[model samples]
Structures are given as structure tokens and as C-alpha cells.
Target: MSETTRSDVIVIGAGMAGASVADALSRDCTVVLLERESHPGYHTTGRSAALFAPVYGPAPIRALTRASAAFMANPPEGFADSPILTPRGALFIAREDQLADLTGLHNELQSEGNFKELDDSGIRKMHPLIREGYAAAGLYDENCQDIDVAALHQGFLRRARARGCSLFTRADVIALEELANGWRVRTPVGTFEAPCVINAAGAWADELGQKAGAEPIGLVPKRRTAMQIAAPAGAKIGGWPIAVDVAEEFYVKPVAQQLLLSPANENPDVPCDVQPDEMDIAICVDRVERAFDLRVGRIETRWAGLRSFVADKCPVAGFSAAVPGFFWLAGQGGYGIQTAPALAELAAALVLGKPMPPEMVIEGVELSSLAPERLSA
Candidate 1:
């Protein structure tokens, strides 16, 4: 039998959520991060074509995202070699039938961002590739931007390691048992014990929770498929913002010399390395061609990623109601990357029993809103 290891905290999953929280928690606690995969972020984090849309997701998420923008715009010295955020606006478009949805969304987020409502002419002017007769209106969010996912993710891991946190790959938890003062986690590598165990296992969060006797959060990992297609020759697409269907049926965004397209599918799936469905790819092409003045002659690449969510569509954070010393940190949906910085800070503070940070307070973070008990009730 392997000798039992100990740490102040054990964070499972080593992806953005685990790494960022480990970075924050490592400031005062000895942290040990574990990932089942051979490498951290080999799953959803690495597959994500990430963007920072402050007005995205539900209220809690938007609040967290707003709280995160400052750090991403200006991270600490040595956090990363390159800037984490680059300007890349977002445009939510609507057909005539969906104009009311666009109007309602605009009113809801008017104060959340630098927003402007555009008519069809205005929409076409902003995104010339959009079919002239397709769009009836648009809501432009100028504050949205593309995220340097790799740098931000690596920076968190680097900082955590520098702060004396240990990271282990191929550490797939097989069993979890609660001791009088802490919890024991058995994995392929060996056994680890910590006073606090954070379940940030992404799609497998609920499964891990079961092993630890924690309450279920009803996390459903939904598959979102995307594909890359070549851009037209001589098209200056760099300045074009991501064009999203206001109804969220599909969307297209420029990625270097190509355009990334997706049907915005939310098919529920189990925890695994999900792949793009042929039907989803076909739907993507149909939607993109119908919305834009372009044709999908060939798809350069295609893949799928899981965006887990609970019933409320808000992220779960805080101690388990059913199990002591076990924390729940999952269900970020597609907004995980954008909201990581602030969410991690919030989770770390909660874990250490510290008062909520002023940053979160200023953003109107409801202390009990993200608690695991909320879902239990």
C-alpha cells in the first residue's frame, strides 16, 4: 500500500477551475491539484475557443465576469508572457422574426456593457460578410473580447506551483472516504488526504460528489460542436466581431484566416471526451451559409466540448451540505474561462472561511446564491 499523503487542500481536475482555485488557495494553504488526464486541460479547456463576454451567462456569472475583467486586462507581473485579453467585439443578430428577442436582450444588458442597437443596414455595415437580407437587427457589445486561454490557464498553474502547490496528472479518483477531521481520496497513483477537498472535476463533478457522499448538483454536460472553414480570399475579417444568432440557433466567429462556425447545440452527454456529431456539423453549415454570404466548400477542422450546467445555469461553489470538508465547484457552463479569475477568488475565500472580498461585494455577489444548499432546496 502506498503511504498516505497529506495537504491542506486537494483540488480535483486541474483544468481552469482547479488551477485557478489552486492558485488562489495556495497563497496560504498547501494545495495538491489532481487531473485524471495525462495533461491538464486536455479536455474542455484546451478545446475551447474562448472569449470574454462580460454580459454573458446568468446574473451571478455576469457579476463574476465583470469582477474578472480588470485582472485579465492587467494581470500581475510575470503572470503571463502575453496579454490575456485582446479586443474582439461581439454582435448578436436577429432575423425579423427574432427582433423582439434582440430588443429584450438589449434592454436587459444596456447598462452591463458598451452596447448599441443596430438596424439591418447597421448590422451589415459592421459585418459585411453577413447576408444583406438576413438580419433585421443587432445588439453590439463593444466590451467583449477574445481570451488568451492558454496563457491565462498556464499562468494559474505556474503561480500555484510557484506558491508550493503540487500538481499530479493521471490521478483519477476511485474512492473517497471522510475521516474525523478530513477526507481521503484514493486514485491510481496513491492515496491523498486533506482537510478540504474541492470537487472541480468538470463533467465528472456529480460522480465525484457521489463518491464523497455530497449532495447532487444536477450537472449536465452539454455538447457544443464547432468547425473551422477557410475565409474568402482578400477578406479583411480581423475586425469583424463574432456574429451570433439572437435566438442562439447558430453563430460564426473569425479565427485568424478562417471562420469558426457552430450550431450552438446543447445535447446532454455523459462525462467523456466528446466528439462533434455529423448532424451538428451539417446544421452548422446550413446555418452559416444561410446567415452569411459564404459557402462551406470544406471544413478544415471540427470538434466538440462540454459546457456543464445545473438547473439554474449558474456556477456552483461552496461547501457540501451533506458532507463536511468537501467543496463543490462546478457547473460554469460555457462562461468558465471568462469568469475564472473572480470565481476562483470567491471559492478560495469561502473555503478559508474569510469574509467575501470587496471586489465581489462591489459587484453585488450574493453570498448564498452560489452555495450548494441552494440547489439542495
Candidate 2:
């Protein structure tokens, strides 16, 4: 509560990653978590379309997701009350022209592990919204599910609090400086000192590093828009599988009474309150109509958010070779929600010099793949 306080570690964002890191570290050392927003998950964390498809994304991301699946499937012994992931399979649609691309993707994912390929009938059975126009269909890993992001985040916070860690909301960090023994961060609330700083500031991660005089990591915040509509024609959204275009052009999923869809746009943006562009929504509806038999009706609501990514889109974790005591935990892309469990634990392990948790350190997660050194190399 003093103008400047000391802690064993300071986390620069209270979203999923920061909260999880704080929770992991709190058991061994005092942790201080700072959030710029009025509340946690107010930014991209709250805005995510919480899907946990282990086989989704590029190689490293998929690996991280696969590693995190066990924890998500069973959490820890006493992590939470209800299950974190609910059963919800995902379907990928392929138009006649897209069959080749879909085939290649299917083969690629299948080579990785558990994702299976489903026939056209299987896709329709899972997502009835598919119309007579599509040529073929594919199925991804059956273990995909909707993640209860808020509950998982709150669970981490609860654990951190129980371990005597401190959290400061609306404490936007404005500056970071290196000291003899640690780092000094200036925030809206006050200055705090920590032996190490975790840059989990989401979209503003690169800015945080810049404030501390660290080299740029090429963090880019890409905009993604989603809108809700009346369930497509005869589609009942509650249990429908997530329907995605084979080209990653657009995607749809059942939320409640209505359906959620997106055009998968990736325009560069700065961190802010993201709003859906009218053009983007229209394009999404057009693409949906083109792929399926559904007539786009009313758009009930729409929102947009930034999915921050590094140059290669793989997450940056581990200590910076240039900046002493600075760690990178950003560029999660859109996989943050699903990969949070493993990514956070990985960050903690690297910082504390502890043995890597077996489940998360799979094929491509070596330090070289995600180290800050890669930026300079």
C-alpha cells in the first residue's frame, strides 16, 4: 500500500496469462499483479470466443494447446468447482473449390495427432446449417470444447489471493526501469519493485518493453470481429458444432438462441475498445450465406477485439537476453484462452528455474523457439 513496495515478482497484466502467472508464482514468492483496466479480462480476455480446439493453429501453438489439454480436461486436484471445458465438437467446411486445400489441411492436422476427418454427412449432422452448396466437409479433433474463460481466470485469481498475492486493478503501468537488484515499474497507482517483470500486457506488450528500453519484439495487434444473428434458418445453436470455412475465411458457432460468426479479419490495430465495423459484419454474413444454405437475418449484436501476435505468431516466453529480469509472455494470437493453462505455467517455470512441467514442454516449445533472443537473431 505504500507509494513503492517490493515483491518477488510483478505481472504487468491481469488478464488470463498474468493472473495465471501470478497464481503459479504466489505459492513460492509474493506476487503483485497490475491491471490497467477497471477490472480483469476487460480487454481481449473478456472478448474471446473461448474455444479449446487442441489441433487448431500453427505448429508451436498447436503444441502448446495439446500440452494444455490435460489440465483443461481435468484441471488440477482442487482448481475449480465445475468443469472448465464442455463438450462441443468443431466442423470445418470445404466448398467444391476448396476441397484440395481442405485435404491438405486435414492431412496436416491428422499427421499431428488426434484430429479426425469427417464426411459430408458427419458435418451436416453436427452443424445442420450447412446447405446443398458445399462440396465436402472435414472434422477436427473431437475433444474441442467451449472454455469457461471467466471461471478459469477467476479460479487463478482465487488461488493467487489464497497464497497472499496482491492485485491492483486500474493500475496502468506507464514506465518500467531497471534497478541494481530488480526492476521498478511506475503505474497509475504507485511504483512497485520486483525481482522480475512478466510482460503479459496483451496488445500493449511491445509498448511495455519499449517503456523499459528493451528492444522491440515486433508485437502486432490484429483486429477480429464477431457478430450474433438469429440462428441460421433451421439451425438450433445451443449444441451445434463450430462451423468454419476451409480457407479460414469465416466461421460460425452456436452461442445461445442465436449464432455467432466472423469473417476472420486481421487488420492491424492499436490497443483500445474495439468495435465491429459494419462492412466487416456484412462481409461475414455474405461469406456465410455463400458457404451454407442459411439466409442472413437480423444481426443482434457485434463486437471486435485485438488478438496480439508476434512476427511469427508463436508466443514469446522466457527471459530477455537484452533486458535483465524482463520476461515475455505475449503474442498468444487467438489461442490465449485455450493455451493459458500451459503458457502461464511455462512462464512461471522458466522464471523460477524450475523443471518444466512435462505436459506443456512438447515437440516445439524449446527456449529457442520462444526466446526473446529470436527477435534479434
lDDT of each: 0.92, 0.85
Clashes of each: 0, 0
TM-score of every prediction relative to native: 0.99, 0.95
Task: Give the lDDT of residue 235 in candidate 1.
Answer: 93
Task: Tell me the tens digit of each residue's lDDT in model 1 across 212-252.
Answer: 98889999999999999889999999999999898899988
Q: Per-residue lDDT of 135-156 in model 2, one digit per residue for the tens? A: 4767665677999898899999
Per-model C-alpha RMSD: 0.9, 1.9
The candidate scoring highest on TM-score is: 1
Q: Which residue runs does candidate 2 get wrong by more than 4 Å?
A: 113-119, 232-235, 362-364
lDDT of 2: 0.85
